[model samples]
Target: MTLRWLLTGRVQGVGFRPFVYRLAREHGIHGWVRNRSGQVEILGQGRTDRLDRFERALTDAAPPTAAPHIAEREVLAWQQLEDFRIETSQAGDRPWIQVPPDHFACPDCLAEVRDPTDRRYRYPFNNCTQCGPRYTLIRALPYDRPNTTLSGFVMCPACATEYRDPGDRRFHAEPIACPDCGPWLSYRPDTAPAPAAEGEAAVEAAAAALRAGEILAVKGIGGYHLMCAADNTDAIERLRARKPRPHKPLAVLFPDEVSLLRREVNCSEAELACLRSAQRPILLLPRTPAPSLPESLAPGLGELGVMLPCSPLHALLLQAAGGPLVATSGNLSGEPVLTDNAEADARLSDVVDGFLHHNRPIQRPADDSVLRPIAGAVRPLRLGRGSAPLELELETGVPEPLLAVGAHMKNTLALAWDRRLIVSPHIGDMGSRRSLEVFRQLVEDFQALHGVRATRLLCDAHPDYTTHRWARESGLPVTPVFHHHAHASALCGEHGIDEPCLIFTWDGTGYGADGGLWGGEALYGRPGHWRHLARLRPFRLPGGDRAGREPWRAAAALCWENGLDYTPPVTEPSLLRAAWQRGLNSPATSAAGRLFDAAASLIGLLQTASYEGQGPMLLEQAAAGCAGEALVLPLLTEAPPWQLDWTPLLAHLRDGRLPVAQRAADFHASLAGAIRDTARRTAADHAFTRVGLTGGVFQNRLLTELAQSRLQAAGFEVLLCRQLPCNDAGISAGQVYEHLGGQRGED
Candidate 1:
């Protein structure tokens, strides 16, 4: 008898080969196991009964992460003469395998780290085939040690022995290492070895302070994070005060299942399942009035971002604290998440009690990814950790190699090669010198490694943006990609939906094709083809950039633009009146995000935003309780490109008398409703089935759900972005979509 098997998806790097070797030897089956580029394949020959047992064990008792498929057909047995000898990893000649996302800690490795008797006991960097780092540490493909950050560390004799042993837990585990040989921890300032007693003590003290109502900044695998007990009202308030993160919901880390139920409110069985999944994202569950926690943890938000223990050290701290902790990106408001320990130590010194950190270097700064199990299964709210540096499926026919320079904010660069879209890790706003350097590095690295030559460059139409400026100077033919088009195209790529649908691109700032700041938009669009169909009624952005910080300026502008009776009260709302009375504000701007900001301000909620999208985010939070339509945004035929005018809609906001929450809800409902009606009309005219929604505004859960529901109800199979973000972080993907879906064809 003879047998063979095929493996796929993250099967490489994990110790599948050794397990197969041992299982084959034990069952007295003769076989050879080796890796193919993207998969593992095995061939075995033995007696029927023994092969059957071997096959069962391969699937049942294999490494927890190894997923294998067996194939058997009649073939002559290559009868074994003696014991099984380990085979070398073979090259996988085939080309279609995707590089897997870095794996989170596995249970077995965690068990060993916790077990005092285990050789890897207390090993902070403990990893095996079943689990460890993946996307964060990997630098190149074919997943060999030489291609990863681990390339520098050579395995010790003990680790090497286990690495090659058929019976050892780490056999064939590429990142396999013990404390003796793997990466070690050290402190930065001292440079001398900081023993656990001396080094980790400060971390313990910080945790203690957190438990006692103090915030601490802790450095993790990817970047720095601000931590404090979620249950401690003082700690939450302190973190908020220090960071100035007032309204946006802070992400919390739960110890286990018990704490998950205890804190967050609406936990459906599906959400719980996803929470426990290996992805380990910050799950968005409904908020609960929990005992022991402060309501201010999530501010005005209806739901919270929560995650279970991802690292062994995180587990220990949570256990010591005895509850959930507020874990948010460690950065001062607009800047990127800090990856350098020194930066965190210097900047967050006063903000936190002390730094709970180690010396293991972070190659890139990736933020904590947020996710929600909406419309079935899990979808990414923010694509990071376990999900970034994504490679898109490209059409191989593109005539020229193009570099899609993403937006100026939440920047990510895309290099398209022979239909493969290689996206860089999230680069923060490129306006800063540091972010600009990172962007340049990403372009160079991708071009060098992927062997892509820049024949043409594409960028946002924004002239002043660093991305656009760089693309212009790149000496490549530059095509200016419109902001809303890229936004819509990103959602189109996610679902591969190619036809025209209604696109609602509402964000803080985007250069409209009409030579104005266009955030509020409703367009009939596809990946490559989009026509401006409608937009929010135009108004001058009061104080220009100041409108973002103070939503009230736009709030007052909304009142003053259309005919309204008395001036707003001269109290807290007076700021808007003053901005209006003074000629400091603009009178002709059309931005959807500003509309949201204004709405939030109108309710006396988020008068000022601590961060980007903060005002609108709080508005969504406040509107959670307010559903059902209270007002309808009227459609008027006013401008070219846009078939409908928003002037009538502003008229309603000026006169409608509804409660703040109800007004907010009606605003969202009408926007989605209008989009649905417009999309129906657009699709009928365009004669297409696919409807794709993208952009920052689509990040709104309420708006997303409403638009999806209405579109489906209208006999359209609507596609929503799940894998990539609808926000600017995903704009690079959209840019590639435009490049690929462009008339030149091919990726």
Candidate 2:
């Protein structure tokens, strides 16, 4: 009998073809296995029983890395052949197969690095088919060594032997290399005779630099990372100063599980599993009562971003140092992570003590992904490194390939082809030159890698956005989607819900249809046809852009709207008051985030924000200890943009006798109540049954849970973000969904 099989789902660059070849040889079948786009194609001829067993084993007992193996088999003409073998990969113009993202170092590679007797002992670039860089190294299709960064390093005779041997773990590994033939590391600022070192010596030198309370720029799988001992206050403070990032938490890479446990970082089984998984992202875990790290590391935040070593080099560095190290993106503030060695030396020379760079080139730069456990599931904050180029199966198809250029902040790109949506890794903010360059490269690379040309480009409606300008200039047909609408579309697309749903989109700011900044919108409809049903009442943002930096400005705006004669604690409050009164540079905005900031500032919990969401974070922290019913607030029904007036809530907050903690909790409850009331009223008016909560404001766990429970009690199915974030980072996905979900076409 003859059989032809097509296998999909993480089959490429994951040792699937080699596994198939081994299985064929074991069964004495004559067949060949090769990668076709994102899938594995196999043709085998043998006894009927043997073919059946091969089919069963292919799906059941494939390699550990070849996951979600979906197989389809067809009977074919029996072809007589002497032996089974692996065939050359067939390239296509469209991305129809799944490309496995970069994975953590496998156990075998780690063992080889730890074993002193092994030839690869302490080797920084030690990797195999089961693990190591895949997405970051691959420059083009076929996923062969010639198409990857490893093309520069020819394999040694011993490594060649392992590559050819199907039974070996490194069989057909694209990145197979050793100390004698692979890329070597070098120290920057060329001062000493032994500036460049190979194998164990290079690893030790980098580790020694970390031990001496100095920050080192270490080249990692996706990009460069700044490393320093987590316990060293001077090093942490210095790193913060160099980056000019004051309050945002830094991720800590612990040497081992014991070291992590000793720090008393709270972790559930699921979180620990994610930390140890192949996609080793920085897991944001709760901090213990007495956290071991310096307060400056994660000041004002309750959770600590922690991760285990994802690469053999990271493991070796942490092992040699014998302590936790602060691992942050190797870049200045608001810029993309540095991947090029020359760029690192040029940009990070003064910031880092020394550079630990390797000769192996990096095709693209990706930062470490950040994730948090919420309601017993992992949620992505920044999708990069091991979790990027994320593929989401779309229930609907598009007319042609589509590109969705995301928002200005937390920028990411997305591509829609056939019934799949591929969201690119997080590309940071689009404001910086480096970040814009990275975004352009990522878009072009995605096109080339997948062999798909985007005929249509979807962008945020904001006319001033860099991504929007890029789309307009691309020569492709452009579709401008509203910012919050994209957020709603992303969640709807993920759940495969094509029907109209109630979307409560809350965030800081989005370009609204009324020529004003809008957030905290309650819309009712589907992707392409959604219309805003109601929104928070517009209030003047005193000093315009300065309102985000100073929460007191938002407080002043709220106070002015409510006719309160109160002076806010701010620099030149009178100037801000004049701006609000004269409408000079004070833009009217209906934003839930501004409301949170106003409430926080009113209670004196937070007046200034060092980071993007700091005020809301502190407000949530203060509310953590208070337990009470939601305070009553007026839900005014005038028209179009209905008002959820904060007058009653502000009156309660004005009482100085009440504890700030209680006021914070009451404020959260009141806002949640307002959201629930608006959602319920909109759903009843539209006769909708499902409600989707999206946008950055939903990142607040307290508000999410509160709104979700209330909506459920009010008899509506709730759709909350699971795989993708609720922030602007997820806008690309929603954009793609909005672009394609409404269209019906054939490939």
lDDT score of model 2?
0.84
Q: For every model shown, what is its TM-score relative to the native structure?
A: 0.85, 0.96
* Candidate with best TM-score: 2
Tell me the tens digit of each residue's lDDT in model 1 across 1-747. 766676654455556677778778878877687766556677777778887787778778867655554523345545654555655555555433445555567888888878989988766677777677666565655566776778888889988887777777777677777777775543222222333333335445556667777676777767788888887777777777778776567888888766556556668777776666666678887777653456687766767788877666677678767778889888876566787877777777767765667656665666767777555546676666656657666644567777888898888787775566767666677756667765786688656544457788889988998899898888889988888888888877766666566667777788887778887776665667777876766777667888878787777677777655434434655575566667565646777788888777766677767777888877676678777583445556554444334444454444447566676677778777877776666664566666666677777888878878888899877777777777787777788787667774332
lDDT of 2 by residue, 4-36 (tens): 888777787888888888889989789788877
Q: Which ten residues in a row have the lowest lDDT in candidate 1?
A: 187-196
Worst 10 residues of 2 by lDDT: 188-197
- Where does candidate 1 stray beyond 4 Å? 1-12, 15-98, 140-142, 151-154, 180-206, 373-377, 395-401, 445-456, 565-587, 638-640, 643-657, 744-747
